[model samples]
Target: MEALLKAVVAGAALHSPLATLVQNDGTEVVLEPPANKGWVLYTVQSGDTLIGIAGRYRVDPKAIMYSSGLEGIKLKPGQQLRIPLTAGRSDREPRVPPGVEPYTVRSRDTLKGIAARFGVSELELITANPWIPSLDRLTEGAVLHIPTGQKGLLVRLSKGQTLLDLSGRFGVSLLKLAKVNGIDNPAEVAEGDLILIPGILARTTYDNLLAKREAERQARLEAERKAREEAARLAEQRRREEAARREAEAKRQARLAAQRQAQAQTQARRQAAQPATVRRSNFVSEGGYTYPVKSYVITTYFGRRGAYQRYHTGVDFAAPHGTPIYAARSGQVQVAGWSTWGYGYHVVIDHGGGVDTLYGHMSRFVVSAGEWVERGQLIGYVGSTGWSTGPHLHFEVRVGGSPRNPLAYLP
Candidate 1:
């Protein structure tokens, strides 16, 4: 375990910037300088090895080893290793700073192809164009501003609908295409989708670029305003519908409450009219007669003691005029007529048992003397007439021709 740990530590130390380490057995390990020195930087490309890279940059393998601190000629994708320039070549070409221009996409382009064409690495292209999600899914005919001094070819996919066909035409992997567009499935893309192509190109000098950007901003604002108005209109319509529904429900409830109140009032009147157990005997009598009107309180009795020395033969019932009167029993009207003396309008009913009932001082009589009337039939209306004081019904019960006490037969 100790030996393994020591080997790992020694391997890490070789990559650090320090003097070379030599063992007692004469095993030599070379140390490199820091990569921050002023040297030309090159990014690794696809199919790039240390030998090919060293050959392309015109540097010795041992010199690269001394500068990069690599134990062997191994190169990985996107690795940034410095290229030591010849002393006189320093003033040959100026290096461009990062983020200088936009990129333009072209037909049948790939990151590897673009990097190879522009003498730059795929990693440098990716870094320069951060707006692009991935380099592998660049769309054809889409323009990107290329940084001025960067070296790389911008590869773009075709603008047509067939992504699979476009990928085939461009010689780019389908997986890379999906990665660039953030599409989990490559089959989901249709035609005419815009994709970013990674490349370095000469910057354009178009003067209307700022105006075009402003126009796009204005268009976006107008769209948002229209959307908000439409949403508000729909919300107002919904509120009006809700209010109408509530009003209809309230009206229905009010109608139901009115019906329920009417029913309760009817029930109370019925219950009040029922005879209590204690008052039942008071309403009954041994005689067969019932009162002509309900609650027929006597205002005047049969006999009268007055200054004129007269006698009153009938009982006067204090009641509202036009109150319904029933036949004393099943009977026929004997004499129904109007008179000016004592009775103004009167109705006489004769029962078969030689008993007769007289209703006098009536406003009108509904039955004539020849009319065959039944018990409880309304025969006349009460009134104050023919020497009467106020509205009252004059009632008289006679047996065989003589007036009798009405209370003797009333129930």
Candidate 2:
């Protein structure tokens, strides 16, 4: 009868076009049933609990425990649990499709502000439209072609730096800088004065002006050589013709000097038109947190694993077992405990404003649950515990009970 039951289950799994049940370690297995089945199997990882795992997956903890058959509701890494796939909908908007309308620069516009408004990065904006100058100078009426399918505007306030300093730093010409900013004179800019910097325009204008200046300089040098030859010929003629020819040679030399001065002025004007580029502070409010360890890579990610039939639920940072873990932000510890389900030792910190963080699979805990810890304070050590395949720390950030992407919060 037992053999028949097993065979029946296997047959049901194979024949059911909507779902497939795979055998797990007697206690846990994934059921990849059809979408209509409405429930899927999730694998538990180190440091996962029925409540925490349920919260991460957006299901009721008690419901998962009961449905998965928990005599004691104990979870083990690689343990599979039944989960309903149709749970919650993420609120993030769909990304804009590529190749949309180009935006022209309006008066008083900054790349940073534009990027923030469009929900895109400043780097993306600059790369999309290469014609805009990279500097903070935007001309009053200069036209800019915006790239298709970009979003966001995160404008930064202009730092009170001189045009000369900015020019050298960003490699833009003074005149191009002035043209972008609509400044008649570069010297008029005062400290604390705000200005819109155009990055692509500065680069293009500077390169073109430098090339033109070099060409003009070469032409002038060639002209001067010919003029010198002509003057020499005139001197020789005057010497042969005696005192009467001296006046004519003097007039020729005077004309050559005036022409050289005019050429010099024209070159100076061209140089003055280009502008400078600069790197402004993108931080408008408080700066974001920095990484605790100098060098650590993510070996595992937060989610469900195939082997356990449950959700993993935390980001895994690979490091030495005893590598110190620091508080990502100033927060009070909430939970610190040991378990068999995968996380051997773990700590959860509650940072105010609905932000809670979890650190799992620790070799040691420096602070007890409920203790206030400052940002960068040593909180725990990394370890290979529970269901971890190797030595690493599983980290998670939770808003209420739902898991969110950690990279979005970190710098």
Q: How do all models score by TM-score? A: 0.30, 0.29
What is the Cα-based lDDT of residue 143 in candidate 1?
39
| Worst ten in a row by lDDT for model 1 | 198-207
Tens digits of lDDT, candidate 1, 1-411? 454346545443333234566666777766554332335566877556666556444467677767776677777889877666543232223222243443445568775687677665555555444445444556653434343453433333333445567466556566665555456766655432434322333122111333444677788899999999999999999999999999999999998778766754564355445542222212434565666776544655666434333566777676677776667666888998877568888888898678898888888889988788876678877887676767878888888988887766767
Q: Model 2 scores what on Cα lDDT?
A: 0.59
Deviation in Å, model 1, residue 61 alpha carbon: 99
| Most lDDT-accurate candidate | 1
Clashes of each: 16, 72
Model 2 Cα lDDT, one tens digit per residue, 230-296: 9999999878787556777888888877776575455435533434211211222143454444345
- Global lDDT of each candidate: 0.61, 0.59
